[model samples]
Target chain A: MSLVMAGVVGALFGAGLLVSGMTQPAKVIGFLDVAGGWDPSLAFVMGGAVVVYGLAWRLVRARRREPWFDAAFHLPTRRDLDARLLGGAAIFGVGWGLGGLCPGPGLVAAGGGATTGLAFVAAMLVGLLAQRRFARG
Target chain B: MPTSWLLALGGGALIGAASALLFLTHGRIAGISGVLGGLLPPAAPDRAWRLAFLVGLVAAGVAGAVVAPSAIGASVRPLLAVVAAGLLVGFGTGLGSGCTSGHGVCGLSRGSPRSLAAVMTFMATGAATAFVAGVVS
Candidate 1:
């Protein structure tokens, strides 16, 4: 049941990405190109998402002590701003600008069998595995 | 607001709603990178739901492509650049511990200072990269 629920949630999220144009590399790049013909659509998307989620978070905290399917909330507890976070994010940003495809959108497009999406996802998985291997050593 | 902008906002709300639903039922953040990355090594016991979620995400992509092909937009970047971007994105997200979904959406909604910093850093660098890429190409 929980697995089904998770799938439903994932589908909903993917639909949102599709609707918001996140799956469109050109649209994403346009948003990022502030010095060029800046598109503010992505900002609106983020703003809407943040507001809704923020409200829902408050409501959940006030109403429930524990989740229905889990023992406890698995929330991030770290508050410190560290070099790893900043540096990694900086690198990710460059890649995002170049590709205009993040994990969610990339996965979605790949699933749809786009050649470019498949290629990107393949390289991404390799990179992910490489990072883990490096970290372990 | 334009129709596209309104659609973007609505789409974002859907993403947020999905996140909220996952949190409400499973007590998990809908961080795409974290959820997908956790499936790598030292696999968690709760891998079932994660796999289910990804399956649903992919399924949605397929559905969207069939129903609304234009929204899924094609990539203009060459294969090599796309691959490079994919590698950087995967490695960087692994190092940062989150991507846009995790830090930009969930973390910010929860009012995490760390997330704020990460978002700021990535947004700045992403814009800068886009600007440079535009200049060069």
Candidate 2:
């Protein structure tokens, strides 16, 4: 039941990505290209999402102590900022600018059978594995 | 606001609602990288929900392609660029412990300082990279 609910939530999220034009590389690049012809559409998307989620977070916390499906809420507890976080984000930013597709949109597009998406996902998996190996060693 | 901007906002709302739903029901953050990354070694006991969510995400992508083709755009970047971007994205997200959905949307909604820092770093670097790419290309 919880798994089904998770799927439903994922579907809704993916639909949102499509509707917000996040699946389009050109649109993403346009938004990132602040020095060029900047498109503020992505900003609206982020703003709208953040507002809604923020409200929901407050409401849910006020009403519920625990989730419906899980015994405890699995929220991140880390408060400290470190070099790993900053360096990783910097690298991600460069990749995002170059390809204009992050993990969510990349997965959605690949699932829809785009060759480029597939290629990107494949390389991404490789990178993930490589990073894991390096981290372990 | 333009019609497109409204759509973007609405879509973003939907995304937020989905994230909220996941949190409210399952006590989980809709962080794509973390959800997907946890499955790399497949040791976690809550893998079912994660897999289900990804399946639903992919299904939505397929449905969106059929229902609203125009919103899903094709990639114009070359194979080499796409692959390189994918590598960077995967490795960076792994090291950073979050991506756009996790850090940009969910984390910001929760008002996490780490997330704020991550978003600022990524946005700055992303915009800078886009500017450089524009100048070169």
Candidate 3:
């Protein structure tokens, strides 16, 4: 039941990505390209998402004692900023600029049968595995 | 604002709604990298939800393509560039521990200082790279 809910949530998220033009690399790059012809359309996207989520967070905390499926709310507790976090974000930013695809959109695009999307997703997973291996060693 | 700003805003709300549903019910952040990353080693304790989320993401993408073809776009880049971008994104997200949806959307809403730093860092780097790469003027 929880798994099904997760899938349903994912689907809605994916649908949002599509409708908001996030699945388009050009749009993402355009928003990021401040020096180029800047497009502020995505700003609305961010604003809308933030506003909604902000309200939801408040409501959830005020009313919900426990999550529907989980015994308790499981949230990230790490608060300290570290070199790993900064460096990784920098790396991610570069890749995002280069390809204009993040994990969510990449997965969605791949599912849409784009070969380039498939390639990106494949390499991304490999990169994840490599990073994990390196971290462990 | 571009003509598509409305769409972006609406779509973003949907994304936020999905986030709310997942987080409110499960106490999960809906961070894509973390969700997907945990599945790499196939740990059975929490694999089901992640897998379900991903499956739903892809399935939704496919469905969206059929329903609204224009919402999806393709990334036209060299195979090598695509591969490199994918690897970097994967590794970076792994090390950094979040992506756009994770850090940019959910974390910021929760008012996490770490997430604020992460979002700024990645957005700056991403924009800078876009400029350096000549994608931005």
**Which residue runs does candidate 3 get wrong by more than 4 Å?**
B42-44, B135-137
| TM-score of candidate 1 versus the correct structure, residues matched by position | 0.98
Candidate 3 displacement at residue A79 in angstroms: 1.7
What are the Cα lDDT values of the candidates?
A: 0.89, 0.89, 0.88
In the range A1-137, model 2's lDDT, one tens digit per residue, is 88899999999999999999888988999999999999988988888889999999889989998999988889999989999899889998999999899999998888777877788889888877777887788
Q: What TM-score should be assigned to candidate 3?
A: 0.96
Per-residue lDDT of candidate 2, residues B1-137 (tens digit) = 89879988998998999999999989999999888888896346789889999998888888887888777778867889999999999998888889999999999999899999999999999999888988888
Per-residue alpha-carbon lDDT of candidate 3 for residues B10-98, written as tens digits (9 for 90 to 100): 99999999999999767888888888998997443788888998999999888977888767787756778888989999999998999
Model 3 per-residue lDDT tens digits across residues A12-33: 9999899888889888888988
A46-94 in candidate 1: lDDT tens per residue?
A: 8889999999988998999899898888889999988888988898898
Candidate 1 or 3, higher lDDT? 1
Task: For each candidate, report its DockQ versus the true two-chain complex.
Answer: 0.85, 0.84, 0.83
The docking category that best describes candidate 1 is high
**Which pairs of residues clash in candidate 2, taking residues 3 or more apart in a chain or in different chains?**
none
Alpha-carbon TM-score of each model against the true structure = 0.98, 0.98, 0.96
**Cα error, candidate 3, residue A30 (Å):** 0.8
Worst 10 residues of 2 chain A by lDDT: A126-135
